[model samples]
Target: MFIEPDYKYMPTTTGISLPSPKGSRFVASCIALTCVLCFVLPSGYSYGSALLCLTCIPLLLWFRPALSLTREDLWILSALVFYVIAHFVIIQYHGSASRYFEEPSRFLLGIFVFLAVIGFKPSERSWWLGLAIGTILGGMVALWQLLQTDLPRAQGFMNAIQFGNLCLLMGCMCLAGLGWAHQQACPRRWVWLLILAAVMGLAASFFSGARGGWVALPFLLGLLYLCFRHRMQRRFLLIGLTLMTALVVTLYLIPQTGVQLRIEQMSSGLGGYMQGTHVDQSIGVRLEMWRAALAVASEKPWMGWGETGYVEPLVQLISDAASRTQVAELDHLHNDILDTLVKRGALGVIALLAVYLMPLIVFARVSLRASPEDYRLRAFSLCGLLLVTGVIMFGFTQAFLRHNSGVTLFAFFMVVLWGYVRLAEPKVHSE
Candidate 1:
């Protein structure tokens, strides 16, 4: 009697062969260099970086011509293209195309570079390892900055918020690395490196004093706990519990440290709310800004005033009500949703939501369908958790989506998610 061949035992090549360890090292170096350029290089590098990213696209295509696009990838690309067109329409009708042209094209280019990287099919595991190495470098830079400063001054290549955001992303990467390392066929040394990376990332976040990071940290931690509650090793669970307890204790005990200071600084803006003095002068400013935005929105509810269009109008509106000194020199609205609403109007908001929510939807679907035995699924789940936390925290006090650091990190994670989803999908068998 002849027995059927074991289907599960068949050896198959990964879609993209794992690049050699040296190649992984080179990729890691590139990631670190990109981070440094984005953070430390002067603002003028924005255009140059876009050019460099454009140069990478054809290189990736040449390297992996067999790359096939998935339905999910198509959805993401379509959403992005639609948003670009929508932005141009709004700029043509209500705003200056020149202002919109300056930053948006670079963001779109960054997205292209990111997707190209994802498409390159380097060993699925190598991408996580590379990201972990990049996170280690970023963490070290942040820690060095913290050591050099006595007060909460922005250091390194980015602003305080951006630094904090990087720390937050690094922390997430570290967690994913830990999961990846555990599942790898590598020796003990790689595990040690991942453990070191995770600790360093957490420490960097503690030192950065970014209030937005403070808000995001717990959410990510909670997500990890929920995801791993059932299948994690007992020692791992114990370590996680201890870390959570220590974090809580630290939060209660350390009143003047890290994120606490930033929170206090923001609260200072609300000082008048607590004391009766200058209540109208303090909290009144943001309130007035919100009211002015609403008034503008009512006037052009469909098309919006366009990018930066609200500045002159907002300045004029505030100058009329109070002393020149009282009016805040406004940038984008402090609120992300409100900023989008003012800049893009109703259609812009829909576009913004599509950009933000698509990843969450995609990640959730992937996580639900992922195999219990697959390590890539765990990494994807961890990334999804971090993205959710970052989005919620950013909603409170940041317009991260509009800023360079935020946009770059967002694009990077999008590519990571795309790569993991591709790796997770079951391949078709050919007879």
Candidate 2:
């Protein structure tokens, strides 16, 4: 579907250089488009990523070897490609049509986007500001949804869980941006602006009432602390925690936000789960799903049952009819590990683990370059770490990779964040 543009040689022929000033700016706009529209509109984030991915074809054909791509980045691209191939093999083994190809295929396509970002080296400012602006606008959309409709959750254009989790993740990226913003001309104003974006993003998350997303909060705070502990003062940490506590309490007290009701619902579910009474509920159903997944996987260890093949056994394994019915109605197991383990076994385990771990490793290694003076590199590294950590933690309660939005956001954001960190510090990738 991509036409080879006639202007492919324009940057080279006109006394221009690779990674020219104009090229950087153009790439910056492309990144900005990706972040700014990430959650504000329906699948809007993909627009920019599509352009970036499309750019990869020509780059691969023409400039593959001379490019500045590093060994570590290729590690990530290879892992993503492996995921797609692994999933495709699973599909072929199951004899299913390519109906299940979309999700993992996202990771494959993301490799192209990663190549484009690395080759072009998009503006880091564009990345952070675009993230903040997108979260701000997305929060507004969620607010409008809350006030104008009777829906219990403000999902915007996505499922409430995906919408809320992504908003929270981008907001965390805004928090990570503070490190870089300090070096800017208007540091104080930019700091406050990023803080506001963070608040708005959290607000949107609360409004969506996505309790599964809430599971990642402690892990989020932990990662933030690890990344910023040396950079941030103890008082600032205390103050931030105090403010967060106050914010959660305030949101809980507000009836329209549905925060309190959601908490109460979870509490009741847990209590009923303890007494073995409400087997039909969300928490109970998830527990049953996990148990069923484990049971089925034990029967076929290497490559477990196919998607459709596992359901009958899953239903048979569950004792509660209500829980069985609930589980049967769904495609995923509501847990990423269990779903992957039950369906694709060793191949999937490797792919899923790589999808989470390679980026984590790459960012962790790159973040080591954040010396006291280099806040820009530090900021991008922290953002990448925080984003991946959020995805990993969020997967515990949701089969996040099962959703198109989840796959799109994770794949594109990983590349953009990693690319920015590497571009900002050229030596980080080599080290």
For model 2, the run of ten residues with the poorest summed lDDT? 1-10
For model 1, the stretches where C-alpha displacement exceeds 4 angstroms are 1-52, 60-64, 95-99, 187-192, 244-259, 266-271, 274-288, 315-327, 428-431
Best by lDDT: 2
Local distance difference test, each candidate: 0.60, 0.80
> Which segments of candidate 2 are over 4 A away from where they belong?
1-16, 19-22, 59-66, 426-431
Report the number of the highest-TM-score candidate.
2
**On residues 150-269, what C-alpha lDDT tens digit does candidate 1 reach at each position?**
656444466666666666666665676565567657836666776666665665666666666667777777777766676688897898679756864674367544556555555774
Q: Relative to the unseen true structure, what is the Cα RMSD of model 2?
A: 4.1
Per-candidate count of clashing residue pairs (backbone under 3 Å): 1, 0
Q: After superposition, how far is residue 166 of candidate 2 from its true place, in Å?
A: 0.7
